[model samples]
Target: MAEDSGAEKTEQPTPKKLQDAAEKGQIARSKDLGTAFVLIGSAAALLVFGKMLAMAVLTIGQRMLRLDEKDIFETNSMFTAWGDAGGELIMPLIGIFSLILIAAFLGNTLLGGFNLSWQAAGPKASKMDPLKGLKRMFGLQALVELGKSFLKVAVVVGVAFFLLKLFFMDIMALSLMSEPNNIESALYFLGWLFLGLCASTSLIAIVDAPYQKWNHVRQLKMSLQEIKDEHKNSEGSPEIKARIRRTQMQMSMKRMMQQVPTADVIVTNPTHYAVALKYDQGKFRAPVVVAKGVDDIAMHIRKIANGHKIPVIESPALARSIYYTTKLDHPIPEQLFAAVAQVLAYVFQLRLYRKGKGSRPKNLAKELPIPDEFKH
Candidate 1:
């Protein structure tokens, strides 16, 4: 007969799996918007500062050097003019260098703060596959890239055309005017164009920012099959899982054995099962099962009890009841109270016998507390 496969596989993320993937640095990162904002603002400041510095230097040089009509207008003396221009250029170069430094600092700070890593960047089979490369070039990511390019082109063209038409209308109006204030009209038109361009570009940026982020996140999503494959690879194969399970069982047995010495009594099924119960009258109204197991664990429990001089009572039904129903460190249920009481009485009698006193049952007559719902 063919081996039976388990239930139909469905991809679901567990907390452990998510934690493992995060620890392995499988998440994506992007350039921080704050960094871009800082860079752009710094660049604008640098441009203004550069132009101001250039104007100041040029003014100082022209006043100080007093280059006459001979040097200013002579093409042959251009070399002399070039030599003079170099001094004026120094401030602009300084401004540009400062902008670069500021932008680099901002970008580095943003990236450092985010602490991003991509697991896919590590050596991986999929990254090396030709098929994966082809899929990336022709996939949803390609479509998103195409859409982005089209939108950018459309926005730029539309804004440019609108500004050009406005500029043309202002020029036509100025030409029709009886008193053509050429300088005033020109300055007003330039101001309007600058403001319009800034507004239009800002609108595009506002819309594109969120759209670009969504596209990036969508591209990072793993398929159901890919997630399953990753899980299998990271978590180990079925045989390895079985081996891990056996190791865990052994560890659990060891822990259970350690708890046996602390137990007040060992309830047993003679040879098959054992459950250790601990009770502190001030701390607990009823006994708590500390450890319980079957087969080799049961024998281990009995051996530990003997070593500790703790009484072991054989009660097959009580052993099974406590083993199945009570978890480690939980009080036994009221349903098994009567049965457990009898066992405790026998244990107390055994202790009395060992002390060379008349073996008598202490008050086993105390009734177990009835549940609230069962009371009148």
Candidate 2:
């Protein structure tokens, strides 16, 4: 979609879109904010480490000045003296530079967070297009950057002039101070100057940072069609989901029917409902419903039971009770235990009779003791 159509982008960018953009390294960041942070950090480092650094420099300079003419004249002595001076300054310089580097890292990552994407750094054919390059050079972003540069120059110069005027007397007094005092006072005054510049840059950063974030989000605003397409791709369309659900239900029903032959007995509501149950003395505390159904499904269960020679009992109330109160593959409710036990007992007797080991048992009682809660 053409991003030029502002009216079409009524919806905010989804989290997936934002994450995709971030992965591509298209994150919102303000260079001005980073610059401000670095400047302020540098200023702070200077304030904290300036005395130690100055002492190191002074020590090095004094050592060099005190070098004997013989040492200066000899190649080995000259090299040795220079090496010692360098060693004297290394620790203080490392301390100051390490702090500055840390500040720079924090400044760059503060708004957009740290992201390392090779795609952003890689070369692209699109980036080489002459027309696109020209367009970008003359774009609104270019104009904004140009205006920002001017504003920063104006603010820095203005602040510097103000600070100089405010500290005119103190600065002039530095001229009257002698040798080491003059250098120390000058370093102190320079620290204040750095702080003032940092403050001015921070003000510009404060304004620019919010604008950068808002502009980034505005660019990523999504159209309604785009959101719908994203949703369809991520979660699938409603018709496909419904079809998947239907297939799952069919598979589940087929699995339920397969357990029908394993049932000890089938209790039917004559025509409307059927429940198949299994019980084992050691395996279950009570009979469990292995399969159940209604109407046409009930007829299918009865047919399967008859083929397997599993006893089928016509008991409407008991069938309804087990069907309503028990889940497939789960034990019957405690309240239905006595009623299911009676049914199982009769099934056992019928099996023994068919084997010619005992006399045929009487049919199960019609009015089995079903709990009122499971009456339906």
Candidate 3:
């Protein structure tokens, strides 16, 4: 029996089942990837901006502060100049800090769409788990982080060494010249260094972006057991589903009782199943099953049929077939043509039988002709 049951299970999932599973969590959220990119990019931007700001401060102090270049260079006087420059530097530092904060704020808001959950910072019971702590220490995530740090260090060191070599070559070329234009030479060297840095940073960004995205997705992967648990949680357990089915059945029976009053005929397996069918030239080309029920509900359908003066007929095979094959408010199946024709013929005969009249010729044949278009 267990082997038979196992064989009966479907291998493929239904569309509804797949949809229910997907709704369990955001498995493909791009926000996490975007936030990571923003954080890295912002750090790079701030570093570059700080370099530019320091250069600007030096230029301004030389001109606006009117401090002698020799005095600014002397050791004791340099300290005094630096102390005096603090007042001038304060506003620019404040502005730069404000800009950096604004950039960080915008980056987070744009990436994560303004999720302000303070509970994320709160203490959680899950954090107290010893197994979770062990997993954190020796996990795939830790390995990935270690790999990233190693790669970043290697890239930065290699790029810096290459830039140093290029700078040395430029410095050698400058020394060979009879006269070096100090400011122009410095500006040119800075430009080349900036260009090299930009190229190297771009390469790192390109490599890290896809790696971070893949890591984020891997972290969010649902195991087979987790998928099953999520499915059970979202769709409800078997007992709850059974209870819902029972409530739906009770409601269906009540509606069936109401519809029986308007039905033209009630076909039944006597005590087992009942199907109330109705027909009108404008509403239907053929008859429509308006109501159907079984057991105690079938008795209720029969009582309602009798009270409403609708014709009732016993057709055990037809009732059972229709109950299994057709739903409420649907046309009867083509396979039941003969059985349904017989029921309709019996219903027509009721009026003549009630008036003490003789049986009319049966319009329904044993082998009813099937419509050409209806053949499937």
Candidate 4:
């Protein structure tokens, strides 16, 4: 009921809302996740393929320095040397680039699955509005981003400081040692440095992913009115739906009453129930209940029957059974066949006698032989 303002966005996003947002390319994504992915991927690619690439570089250098006089003089040999150098670099470059591309793709998919949207790539005028940009730059998101940057810087700087302090004496001792020892020490330092960087970024990613998700959800929260409007759009508004139902019921009631005047007889519970029956030997094998009603509707049926001079039979059990068991335009069950047949026979006899063409029929069955089960 408190759906007054867009300000009260208290509802979590619905699936349809999320889907629509995705189509517009609105997704929760963290630059830190992508950065972490790229760093890890590049480090892995370089480590796995560094030896082969180093050998290729060494081979190129050797070829360049040791070229024969004939090779330098021939333009074709010169071109061949250049082609060999390019070929050597191509595989390593491709592998590294592919790793970066895969890292970016995976980072995005971690947040919102494999969603593709060109709309996100399109330019917008809002991006160029300096005031809007300034406002965003000073917004809570910007402050959060700034805090993340500071945290990253602090961790990296602190890790570097500690690593340097631990290695200060060993680094100085490197100068006094042989080349291989110094090289080994340097490699160990590089390994530790890479580990520290990876550790810091992994921590950042752990925090950033959830923050991005929460921020995205907060941005997309819906007001109560929005939820109601969405429901109305999906399933008609309640008021309109109720009105439609009422109109349909009235139309159905009118149609049922229209058939009452043509009924052969109106059976009743005398006060509580009524069932109008009609039979035609040519169009039907047995009697059909044209309509049925109770209470106010029963009284209305009696009034209409009286106006039309149609017979109204006060048989509580038959009326209750017909009202309960039979439907409009459908034949009564076989269980009621004998009972209905007797009523039809008496009506036929009474009609013929009224025209003075025959003698009055003997007393009709007082109870109409209604079944025990149908009696209630």
Stretches of candidate 3 off by over 4 Å are: 1-162, 165-169, 172-189, 197-228, 315-325, 333-376
Query: How many backbone clashes are present in model 3?
Result: 0
Q: Give me the runs in candidate 2 sitting further than 4 Å from their true place.
A: 1-7, 68-87, 116-123, 172-175
lDDT per prediction? 0.66, 0.89, 0.65, 0.82
- Model 3 lDDT tens row, 1-376: 3334324322344444434433543222333344444544445444555455555566655745576768767778756666657766666566656655665565445522455344555677888999999999799777866776686677667877888886887766766554225444554666556545545545555565566546544544454455555678878999999999999978876776777898888878789899898877697867788988889889988988888888887766666777777788898876666567767767767667677785664543433344444332
The TM-score measured for candidate 4 stands at 0.64
lDDT of 4 by residue, 1-376 (tens): 4437635899999888998899889988888887888777766666555555666676787788886879868879978989999989888778868877898788768886777888878888888999999999999889999999999998778877887888788778878976445555555555556656665787789899999999999989998788888888889988989999999999999999999999988988899999899999999888998888999999999999999988888778788888878888899998999988877777778778888988898765658777788777
Candidate 1: stretches off by over 4 Å? 1-169, 172-187, 194-228, 233-241, 307-309, 360-376
lDDT winner: 2
Number of colliding residue pairs in model 1: 0
**Ordering by TM-score:** 2, 4, 1, 3
Give the lDDT of residue 20 in candidate 4: 87
TM per model?
Answer: 0.48, 0.90, 0.48, 0.64
- Name the best candidate (by TM-score): 2
Error in Å for residue 286 of model 1: 2.0
